[model samples]
Target chain A: MDNIVTHAPDFFSNSQAEATKAIARSLWNRVLTSVCVALSLLTLVPLVSIIYLVLKNGLPLLSWSVFTQLPPAAGMVGGGFGNAVIGTIVMVGIGLLMSGPLGILSAIYINEYAPASRLAQAVRIVAKLLTGIPSIICGVFAFAIVVSTTGRFSAFAGGVALAVLMLPTILLTSEQALMGVQSAFREASYGLGATKFQTIVRIVLPDALPAIMTGIMLAVARAAGETAPLIFTALFSQFWAKSLSEPTASLSVLIYNFSTVPFPHQIQMAWTASLVLVAFVTLANITAQLVFSKKH
Target chain B: MTEDAARSSATQTPGRPDFLTVRNFDFFYGKKQALFDINMDIPEKRVTAFIGPSGCGKSTLLRNFNRMNELIEGVHYSGDIKLLGQSIYNKEVEVIALRRSIGMVFQKSNPFPKSIYENIVYGLRISGEKKKSVLDEAVERSLRGAALWDEVKDRLHESALGLSGGQMQRLCIARAIANRPKVLLMDEPCSALDPIATVKVEELIHELKQEFTIVIVTHNMQQATRCSDKTAFFYLGKLIEYAETQKIFSNPGQKQTEDYITGRFG
Candidate 1:
């Protein structure tokens, strides 16, 4: 075999430009990470501080009698939060009854089947704007519509008001979740000879169910915590609730009402009610996360 | 039986074209045509392979057999596609049954995020099979048919997501055949598998053709050579050459096929 030699450049040789660029990239990453850390800490510190203060002021008044007995009258020493806590639950549950199914169906219609029709686009725009409408405005809307129609403040009216605020939150979250499902999964189901409705019912919905449930849970939490909506719909009633047509109180509204009073005993009851509300909402949020986390 | 001479002699004695007949079929998606006027006779109980470059209408032609093109937003077709000697495009032809009889596997493996057993039984359940024993037997038979029985036999009750990529592909094959479709369409069945997994899938396809007519789309020429009886060569939506697999590979009569086989152009 004959051999020949030729001059060739060394392609593997290092360059100063590459090294300088690598150092600059490292410095840039450090700056970005520090900024993110600072921003997150800024958010986290206030949340932790609020929770601490709420617990410090409220835990001492959180007693068994507070949950088991009715609210005390003026000049009374002993009191409980039974009516307020039960009313809060009833209002939130009724609100979910109306809002959850309606919001989920609307989300499905928008994300799954609705082509870019004029009606669908208009509804979507309305939902987006509804996000900006204050809880107070929703309260007034429900007050005028549901409360006046019934001729009195009631738990059902509170539910209608809270659900109005909750609907946009649920619809938006569910649409985002449903849209997150891969198109490949949709095509695969369709390719398997499934009809459009069959694909939606059996395939698309199941895959998106976890995310949709998370959204509903967030809405549930929001509805549970709302006071302004409940205030206009459900006026404070120190006595027990008997009917949807009668006035009632929620934990948030009771907290607001009792905290404003000059009596020290009522103030303690308000703090206890606030603590209970936060704890209940926090527990509900945790349960939703556990239930909806996709194992795969 | 290797059965080579018997099949060749049977072809010589053929008196009628098989059930599925494509006569000068032209197909388009929107303004762009994806299949030219193609003439092909797909015999029952035989494996046909469609081989071509990317975007050559192999899968497009396969989907047209069952009018699945109707599922797409805008697709237009000309000429005829006959199933069992009746024009499939005829207004009265039931698309659901047509699709039920013709199963399709995609280029990528997709199994429902369900138990391995449930994945196979999904179609049967949809059609209202309630007897546990019948469904159990079907699950076993289908997994065995796809050659996935041994690897997943111990974990039949486990979630499908626990399976490896190759097993998932086989599970999809099992799912497709569980309904006892008369024809199976595979669009690049092994394009995503490793060489060993590819061999296993190719072998499974060979076994599958004993029970169903298989039309496979593959960019791999060697796969067509090994598994197919008839080979159809496509180029940019046109059917250039379709013949016995040996002739198509060893001695294609078309110049374009020659250029393609010789690697002059893709």
Candidate 2:
């Protein structure tokens, strides 16, 4: 009773009442933060495991020759990913070329110029719907329109399919980036006697640059690893690419083809190719983050 | 100056036959009325400030000067706003061209993420100035007019985003004046700034009125007192008081105006 009385008197003390409340509030916040932190970290374990395994499988087959050689054969010894690397680069570049400007212009219209008109609303709805369309569905649509029309698989058709797949994401992200810019900036430009187009071109675009770049990079990475669209477009090429207008090979398709083959060498090559594609994607992600964030 | 050009501001002002006149103005954002039955005159080559509490239509009135409110979705208005005697809202008028003749500055210092020189010349280039020497001269003149020349002349090529908050505000002012617009509108141009920066901006405002008809919307009563030649106090989209600066400060005619100035209520 004596101990309780001493402690109880302090608890009831006027000077400490506010302090007790503050400490309890902080404790509640800390507990809530810990639960959220733990839940997110737990979800990341499997992702880390997959990357680690891919890296482990890839390290042995990767070499200067792996970069330079063609696929060895069904049962043969040595082949490299040079052709696949070039094909991926060219295809992605072409896809970006086709989609980037349209996406940016469309985003500008939606975010800046649109006045809630029926046409504007319809365009937005269509873009939203397009974003949800499956990559396989895009592939099938391209195969029907392109493969049957051209009567052959070609990199041009693959590029077109990839462009279609990439456009919606680019449009959505670009719109978000444009919208993310504070209206104050636009108003500031207008205040400075700039035309609306000038304000968008000069002030708004530059401010939203880092975010827009991030979106473009996301599109690029997604395009780089896409296989379904490529299968309908890019055929199995063992030889070097003569032109982008014709047939070619890519990492995703090569990996898919080799991974299903009966030979150990081809299987190893598939792992190597997958590793390379994963690395390219990782490098793109890291580059975007590092260049944008000054914290690190 | 020609004798004809040296006559009344009405005859002399480029493109403006007289003052800024808002006649029978009504504003709607689709169906909701934001401004109604507004009538006022902003004199040429003078400073007129719009003062009101939040949501009292101060900023909306400022934007009406340049038709910026048109950028918003569902905003509709019926008014005749004549800038220098030119009917600004005429269907035949090009909004982009009209905006070029009237400059604007915001509460937040919004410098482009570009070089100081580029920020200044953005408007000129947009209006189609391609000569390098001319652009350079205009950049210097604008910076000088904005009271920023001495500070930025050595670093015109440097990114404007690197400047201090006050410097960025001045850079925006420089950009606005580079095109030599006949009128300038400021929307609480220094609310985000420190006291020192606010004073600098106020001084700039005083200097700017000599060449441009300046209209500002300010939350700070002191800013209106220090820099304005004429004060227009707005309440619920109505012009409650419009008079000489000194008179409005010393003897306001309305109870609401007095309360706002004295901080009795926002």
Candidates' DockQ values? 0.42, 0.45
Q: Ten-residue segment with the worst summed lDDT in candidate 1 chain B?
A: B7-16
* lDDT (Cα, tens digit) per residue for candidate 2, span A146-225: 88898888788788888999898898899899989888777766655567687888877877777887888999999999
User: All models: lDDT?
Assistant: 0.84, 0.84
Question: Considering every candidate listed, which one attains the maximal lDDT?
Answer: 1
RMSD of 1: 5.1
Worst 10 residues of 1 chain A by lDDT: A1-10
Angstrom error of the Cα, residue A257, model 2: value is 2.1
> Cα deviation in Å at residue B192, candidate 2?
2.3
Off by over 4 Å in 2: A1-44, A243-247, A286-296, B1-18, B91-93, B255-265
Candidate 1 residue B12 Cα shift, in angstroms, is: 16
lDDT of 1 by residue, A43-153 (tens): 999899879878998898888888888888976877787988899889888888888888888888888877466877887899999989999998999999988888999
TM-score of chain B of each: 0.91, 0.93
How would you encode candidate 1's per-residue C-alpha lDDT over B144-263 as one tens digit per residue? 999999998998988898998888888989988888877788889899999998999999988886677788999899999999999999999999999999999899999999898778
Q: Grade the docking of candidate 2.
A: acceptable
lDDT of the structure predicted as candidate 2: 0.84
